[model samples]
Target: MISKKYLIVIVGPTAIGKTSKAIEVAQNYNCEILSCDSRQFYKEMSIGTAVPSKEELSAVKHHFIHNKSIGDKYTVGDFERDAIQKLDLLYATSDFAVMVGGSGLYVEAVLFGMDEFPEIDPSIRVEIQNNYQNLGITYLQENLQKLDADQFEVIEKGNPQRLMRALEVCLQTGKPYSSFLTKNTKKRNFIPIIIGLEADRSLIYERINRRVDIMIEDGLLAEVKSLQNFKEINALQTVGYKELFAFLTDEYSWDFAVETIKRNTRRYAKRQLTWFKKNEYTKWFNYNESSKTIFDYIDSKKTETEI
Candidate 1:
């Protein structure tokens, strides 16, 4: 019998040390790193997105990091197709590959296929975007809450793009957006061993706060400033950039913007944990776990499954 290939998924909230662990494991297994972090895909938003450092990128080969221009239109569906193709190619030369990221939806897209939605009128999306731009996220948020309370509760409400997408889906389908979510899992050639890294809530908040400080120290402000012209882009609708952009627009003071970034990131981390926790297949470990311990667990899992 042919041996099964393995896909080691390193998942956790932001700033929980998933990157370093991924590198160490990939180095040991001689496999490549495939990042599923939705923010890291853009080339223009490094500091805010927290792309891996030069030394870490050099330590192991990585894919999907800084691979797209912010001006390009990319979706979770696009990433799902691209990632599967890459994994197919990687499996040609190696039996193991590593994927690490904090984007729960993107990670799920690669694992279980995205739900198929009916092709609605293009004007519906345009109308949603116009409402978001003219009336603000509150308009979309209130609408989504009224239309699909369940999806509104789970989705990242701070993300205008997500809010708008859900609203559009609800209106276009004349049904709750949550109604489209399917529980079916897609079959894949590779077996996934999901590893989750976590810390206590207090510690996780502390790390998030410190990471935001480091991002400011590393010139996240300047990076956001450069992308100010592209603020309308969906990729810039995230935590770090949005808060800083508010500062740039004089919506808040510099210090207040930074504080908001920290607070929003903490919320995002919480949401990430909630999403990953739903996956019972994930084996949880402390964020500071030694790479060897994780490697051994992966080895044991591979043995158990392969036998």
Candidate 2:
């Protein structure tokens, strides 16, 4: 019966209407939804992360939404284990479940077990952090660029934590961070069918800008302000919160912070698309495509095994 189980993954860039599609698919299959969005895991981040509306959540059972606090250090590996356990329970009674989010790395972890890497001394990470704090991110960025040009080009250089992680790995292993990535796929009980929603780049940019405006209207500034003390948290170092934090520190004008948020969000969406596109298994759909079309595709994939 494990072969009969299907994990429907609804993936796309931010503001691509993945939430709506995920809910619709879960309802059709009479299944629960497991969220893979990294930001939505933190309960403190709701409006900025665009968590599902109460009515939408009440309409269908959603798991992993606001399930962790900002203070919790939840990694993608942790999420993969947690998700598998939850999926096992869901599969006990149903043949299908929906997983949805724009975080491609987290999505990939759930689909294929995370790539294993050499264990490095904690002191290497500490040294990198110390250098980053004293010498600035530029120092870490330059070091990574020299150590592993391939990863430097693709990794999000703006995130110091990610940069430090890559640098420390390279220094400790004396190898490019990219060299550790494994292509071997992990076995899972359920079949994963990835559905990606896409739109014209210009249209996506417009939608992102509009969504940022909506978040501002939804009291994102106040939410960011309340978490000012926690700005050092890795979770808050992200787009909306980072830009707002800059404003709170008198580093930028209010208008400039809002604009920066929109700009950064657009960039993040681009990175998400790049990551998802690498997976050849993902089927693409237009953002406005009807639920009936998606349902038909899902039905086609659902086949009976000869007993």
Candidate 3:
């Protein structure tokens, strides 16, 4: 009989050391790492997205990091297809693989499959965009909260793209955008061993603030300046870049932008923990837990499956 393959998924909020943990696990299993962080997929977004360091990338052969240009139209569906294909190839030689990221939606796409939404009219989306441009993101946020408070609670509140998409779906269907997300999940061949790293809320916030400061020191401003022309792109509409772009555009002072980045990052980390904790099967470890402890837990899980 063929032994079952395992996909070890390491997840946590930003700045929680998920990358280092993933590298250690991959080295132990002699397998490659596949990144599910949607922000890390772009070639032009290293400092702001906190793409793995050069040493970290070299320590473990990583897939999907810096694999696409900001100009590319990649979606969760594309990542799910690409990641599964890569996992299939990896499993041909090894019984284990690692996937690590903070992007919960993308991780869900790879694990259970993307949620199916009804086809929405293009005109509704266009109308929403026009209103967003004229009335701003506040309009979208208020409407989504009114239409679907459940979705409003979970979504990245600062993401205009997600906000607009949800709003358009709600308008087009005369129903909450989240109602369509209840479809049955798709099955996969490999069993998933999910490990989550966490810390006290105060500690997580401190780390996020320190990391943002380090990004600035690492020339995040220069990186954002280089991508200023593409500021309107969906990928650039994220936290760090968006705040800095506002500074560049004279909409915010430099000090205010930096502070906003830290504040927004803390909020993003909170949302990440909320999303990952919903999975009852996730084996969570403290942020400072030793790798040996985690490895032993993973081994025990694998053994149980075999038995």
Whose lDDT is greatest here? 3
Better model by TM-score: candidate 1 vs candidate 3: 3
* lDDT (Cα) of model 2: 0.89
What tens digits encode model 3's per-residue C-alpha lDDT throughout 122-227? Answer: 8888899999999999999999999998788778888999999899989988999877762668989899999999999999999999999999999999999999
Global lDDT of each model? Answer: 0.92, 0.89, 0.93
Candidate 2 local lDDT, 17-68, one digit each (tens): 9999999999999999999999999999999999999999998999999999
Name the lDDT value of residue 122 in candidate 3: 86
The lDDT, on a scale of 0 to 1, for candidate 1 is 0.92
TM-score between candidate 3 and the true structure: 0.98
* Poorest stretch of ten by lDDT in candidate 3: 177-186
What 10-residue stretch in candidate 2 is worst by lDDT?
298-307
lDDT tens per residue, model 1, 36-77: 999999999899888999999999999999999999999988
